[model samples]
Target: MPTIHLRRRLVELDAQILEQKRVLLDLQQTRIAVERELRETATYPILTLPVEVTIEIFHRLPLEVGDKMGIRRNTAPISLTAVCRIWRGIALSTPTLWSTMNISFDDIPSTVIAKPGLVESFINQWLGRSGECPLSLTFSLPQLEINSLYDQVDFSIRRLRPIIRQYAHRVRYIELDFKEDTRISELELHSSPFPLLQVANVCCDFHIETRVFSNAPLLHSLHLGGEEGVIVTRFHLPWQQLTTFEGFIDNLDLFIVAPNLIDVKCYWSGRESTLGVITHSRITSFTIIRDCDILQYLTFPSLQHLDVYPLVTYDFFESFLKRSCPPLISLGADAAGQGFAQWHKALVHVAATLENIKISYVPHEVMTSLLSLEERPWLSPPWRTLNLLPNLKTLHLSPVYGPVDQFYELVRFLYARSDKLRSFQLEWFTTPFLDAWIGAGAPGAHEKADTITGHFSRLQTAGMDIYVGTPNRNYAAKTHDAADV
Candidate 1:
């Protein structure tokens, strides 16, 4: 009986083992099927399209991306040949794609031009590829190492001069950057003339003595920058089409005149005459860097915006407002905690038509004086009484030192009077007055701060925009002794 029972158990175990083997076989077959399907899908050949269709696809790509594909470099054509025979043919045939070229001779490889014939071949290939289409060229020449690269510069320029002069009428923009003084002077003398050049951006250390602008009849924009005391004097150059001009000059009296000038920006050499020339121009927008007493005498008839640093005195402030009051929309003044009486008087004058005001590095005493002047009738309605411009909408007060109560009082005064007030920006340096002011009040009180917060909150909520370090919260002392004084 025991033997028969053992035999039954052994047969059952054998049957279970056979069943396991069958299951493993089925899994292996399933995996093989999946693998075959994957290989078939992955190895499938991509459909071959017509050459015209492919070319159309390439043209549709962004110019920037095409440029990154190595089209801008002189070796790009040769590199594209390695991509594929079909790609090489397409790249070679696309003359318009190769028209825009950027040449840099600063780091030319020794292997590239070890032989004279190779160098000439490389230059001819790049210039000849453009073929009848107007080419855009960007030349970046380092002035410091021109002595070492002088031969390369001459060779490249000589090779490119024919192409540039031929396509000068079609060229739209030219950017020339020279770092070496000697090379810059040489380039200024021999620079190619562009008849249709509309934009010229030049940055060189040497003084620009060439008559390069004579050929640019349609030149509308000019940006020039270099060392101090660089005088630019040109006569008979077309300024009727010129709209924007920016440069650093010791004097503005050098130029004959820019009749169509709309925007004028200058970094003055602290000279009185330069300021005089800028003030006399009919520019709609004007910006001066430094403070000068002569600013009071100059007038911009069509001027709408003015920005200056190191605020001028109260007398000059009032004089300028009264003189150039019409068409003025925005004004920014930096006092740097120097003159309060002048700033107060200027603030009054600015309260008239100014829409935006930024006062940086103000003193605690000034804040106290401005805030405590509620008793004085003239200061009661600050903006309303003193040249209160009805059109004034935005006010930015920064770097104030005072209590929350003082700030609240100031806000109330401005909110009551400025019906068109849409924004009120505050940059707090040491106080939590902004947070408390926004947290303290009724819907109407919050509404005033909200108007400013809603419009300019995206720029900065705390003192992040302020140049003076991080802000901290401290409200233990109700009255600041230094501020009170």
Candidate 2:
């Protein structure tokens, strides 16, 4: 119906419009994909954090986390590298992430037994990634049973010795775990002074020759434990400057060598003999395990914290306290081999300065007797005394087996210190019974829970922090606990 040129122009315009529509559809699809990706990327905080902030986040991870990753090499620095290009750059530059290298021969796969060079290369690469940061190394080799594997073990040790020698100057902490039958002579590193070393936690099967650690000027903390026991005569630790020592020693006189020690935790069994008197001025904390008769001979003038189990005797502890007369701030009186009532008298000696007290595993009958209104009505409660730890802030006790009246006694005790008391915690020795009680909707469980919660609320309102729940085993173990201390 139209002229020829007009018809041709109309067809060309239609094709141009169709082509533009195709291009518009492509743009719409691309915009939708970009918006979806933007939403996902926005959800991740790491994406928005600066590189420095991200690096610090990784630094705040526990040192033990790296120790755990020693068993699985692919999870840590390696796994972190796989996240993204930016993260990979940040992780590689952060030397602290690689500074703590946990190397256990147990982690070596049997598949790599023949390839000792591979093991050597791996260690070199791992430590090399740390750049120049101070190292915390934990090297452990399992006790070998098969005599035929000695050559292979020697090969790995030979490879490792060179690396240790290279980095010994930078090592801040070195924990060595080896068996007694281990061929100590093969390593040829018995005399090396760790100039920068600060802590050594070593477990050995044989005598650790004093020459093995010639002089550690900076070394302050040492934890030595093993099955054959540590031979103190053969160990020449820098005792004069030592601040913390934890071990089981055959010779009890080793305490005399460390005058500047701040903390001492040991296992001693000198039952019949009285070791001569020893005095330390700087010691602030002491934790003694089984059979500590040596406490009779030692005096710590500055002790603030004391944790002892089955304390030699009430008389022995009182005598030790009198001799040391430390400015007592914290006392763990769990398993004192006596009742709370007897220990209460001992506390009076330091009550003027004591601030925090933890009591656990008290005999049920004794606890009941201590709290009974009728039994010791004459003796005023500890709270009312003017000279007895008026500034006391925290009282942590394990669950006591007694009546509701006995429980209320403790509440009253905290109430008396409500003005100054900051925290009052009742920790469970075992799993919390409240969990199961609340789950099953037991008849009296709600009432019991409400009563505890109400006390917590009142304490909070009165300017105290209250925690009534299961005990954190890690925190208890570090500070003090009945079973562990």
Candidate 3:
């Protein structure tokens, strides 16, 4: 009878324990429901808006580094998705947000680069999320330090070729940077045209022999750089469609390739390069560095803006103006310790149309000579000619050495062109004279400041905006408008 009573008690206790455990679980579930409801209430503000509006807002956010869909974390798209279930749905569905990608091998892990198949898989996933949107892709090849990993890089390129070819039709902008001798044969391997490609920036240390981009009809802007620089490549680009080109050209004559270019920024290395006997009629703007007598060789009739640094000779420009007769409206030049003779001649030709003049580092002697009152019978024809820059409106001088003490001459120059001079700015306009005048901490510092202020006060009576920066660490000076009292 006692054994039977114990067994019954034990069974009852087991049943009671199971009942308590079930009740505790029910309470815990209720707490979770309440917590979730509170969270939804807190996010009600953003959740209240339409999903479309939120997607648009997300698109306007700044682009973040890393491939969140790949190995990278905390990317803009990833963060947006992590916010809430609603946000995650919207972000994953928005195709435009995933349209631009930089697939660079420069800083990626060696393990990933070695496994070309893995890279292709990640890229495939990323592009799949983009949902057929036009892509802007930048591929940066590894530098020389990874030369030993040639086999890995080759494998990686081979893997990426098929993936890139699949998406080539949808790519609008493409940039490639190659630092090593690893030839990018993939560009040539694909025969299909890059139908939508508009802009291309190619930087390679070696000459690319393949005419890979010859069929890209819509391509327009091209920026080429590297040590060996650009030579006629096997890849024939549609040069006729190119309106803007910036790069180092091995050959001076551009008419063969890019004749219709409207804007050209070129670095001509060959000192004697006369851009072959070709005339570029549509070129309106030119920025040349390390230029020689190339200007004399080329004719630019439609040019409106000219910026040159360190001309080979004044005669080169003079002859160019005589030949081209460009209606130049704006001109910028670096004298590079040269005399003002060349400038005077160039100004005489463009004075009728030139409105803006920005000269960097003109010698003090040149400034003094311009402001000098002495008459020189043997001076250049332009110097003898009064109102040299009759139509000049803005004059900006950026002197390499500070405190260009040509203030008096500069003011006089302004007065000469007071009829048309609207603004005059001097960068690094400091002076040891002013410091000495102030005596640093001398007793007459206030008086010195007043004296310099008075000099400028008189100049302000003229009708031009004058801006000068004091010799200080911070360039925080304001313009002293001459028109204002």
Candidate 4:
């Protein structure tokens, strides 16, 4: 009914109205989606992050404070799942977060040794979450002598044995500190090949049938921490496969059997028996936490590190060095009543290759000689132009005895070796004189004291790593305090 131009204009106006409606519908849908996201953020903030990012943040916390005992339930990996449904999904999906567990039960903590099915359930649940990850399990079984207690332990072991057998192949490291009991055999079920087992620490005097693990291609470290000095022959270990051995054993005959053993650490002290001298070519590291002349009967040509509570007699040590010219890189020894001059006789043999020295008790002569203004003959043997401990880079002196005079000598000794020394830790700098002076306010020598301290400061400023006077490191105090003389 309108004019032609007006009619055409009206149709165009209708098309514009339809296009605007489509745009309005799209805007309303976008507003709903944005409001939904805002609600989610307000309700569960952590879930806003990708599930993978939240799981990674949880992994940084210590895994040791765990579900093995009820005491740590609040902090264990399982506790994370209980906090919220969001975290529960994240944790169960992470295998490595639950791969390690430390289970300790004995007569010591009453609450730790729980009922029959409880412990088995705890272990089963903890390990089942590990998926296919290698496990590191530290289990300390009950060391009970009471007949009643043994019954409880037997039941627990029987129930847990199947769980252990199922997961034994996944175990990479396991520590068994169990004493001999009826349940000990049940615990020793590595009778099945632990295909992934690499380290085993066993504390038992009973004949350990480790022969079962001999076929385990990856098992290489064995530690026996029994007190009875269990004879090596009694342990049917996979000696040929082992590269590291620790614990107490006086019998040196094991050296003959362990051709591949490269690291040996043990304690020895008793009647020094005259045994046939045995030599090993592959051992590169050896340590004795207790004093012994165990070195008298054994030798290692490939030895690179020697640490001992006491190297014992100089004659014995010198003789041992003469027989086996090891390429020693580190030396730690305590002078067991041996004089500095005598100890030096044996020490010079390894000076050529020694790069680290940790002397427990710095000999009186050595301390005095270290402070000498001139180079002493003791430090410079005529045999070679280089000084003693030529290549020494790290030195740890447990305690320097006598008075502040010996304490002052430390700076001089360190300066003497400044060319090569980069790290130094003097455990204790206290002496009777320094203690007395410090008690009296140290009036006259305050400036001198500062200067002496300044020497250590100067060394530190020169980029050398130096530390002195650590708390409670006073090994100079006599143990038991029996000798009041």
TM-score-wise, the better of 2 and 4 is: 2
Ten-residue stretch with the least lDDT total in model 2? 476-485
Runs with alpha carbons beyond 4 Å of true place in candidate 4:
1-50, 63-75, 107-116, 144-156, 188-190, 207-211, 269-275, 336-341, 363-366, 377-386, 406-410, 429-450, 470-485
Cα lDDT tens digits, model 4, 1-485, are 55998989999999999999999999999999988888678767877898788877887765444443632322457778887777888888888878877665653234445455666677788788889999887666646656544334333555556766788889898776665553346655646668899998877545543434544779999887777675777667577888999887767756877889999888774546556888889999999766557777878899999887775666777777767888999888885456334555666667789898788876656555544522454544522222656787987776766443554555556666666789887664563332311111111322222344455555565556776664564322322212110
RMSD (CA, Å), each prediction: 10.2, 8.3, 7.8, 11.1
C-alpha lDDT of all candidate models, in order:
0.54, 0.65, 0.67, 0.67
Q: TM-score: which is higher, 1 or 4?
A: 4
lDDT of 3 by residue, 1-485 (tens): 79999999999999999999999999999999998887787747778788788887887777555652232322567678887888888888888877877766655656666653677777777678888888888777746464464544333454657776888899898888776566666555347678899998887644656555666788899887765446744445677789999888767545567777998988876645544546788999998877655676688889899988765578877777777888999988877734344467666666678888887876665555555522343666776543555677887766645346654444345445556767776666454243212111112222223334333443456445666554353221333432232
Pairs that collide in candidate 2 are 190-212
Per residue, candidate 1 scores C-alpha lDDT tens digits across 137-251 of: 5665544343564444233443445555555766776666555353343433235566667776666653545555566767888766565644665323455667777767665
Best by TM-score: 2
Model 2 lDDT per residue over 1-485, tens place: 56998999999999999999999999999999998788557756577787888877777644332332244332366667877777788888878788877777754555564665777677777788888889888778767567544354332455667778888878999887766555444455455667889998877654646345555688889887764345566765577777889887666556677777888888775544355667778889988777556677788889999887656476677778878878999887655464234565566667779898777665566455444532343667542232366768887666554332344554445555666778776654544322111111112322222343344454565467776555563111222111200
lDDT of 3: 0.67
TM-score of 4: 0.75
Q: What's the true lDDT of residue 324 in model 4?
A: 85
Candidate 4 CA-lDDT value: 0.67
Candidate 4 lDDT score at position 289: 68
Candidate that beats the other on TM-score, 1 or 3, i.e. the better one: 3
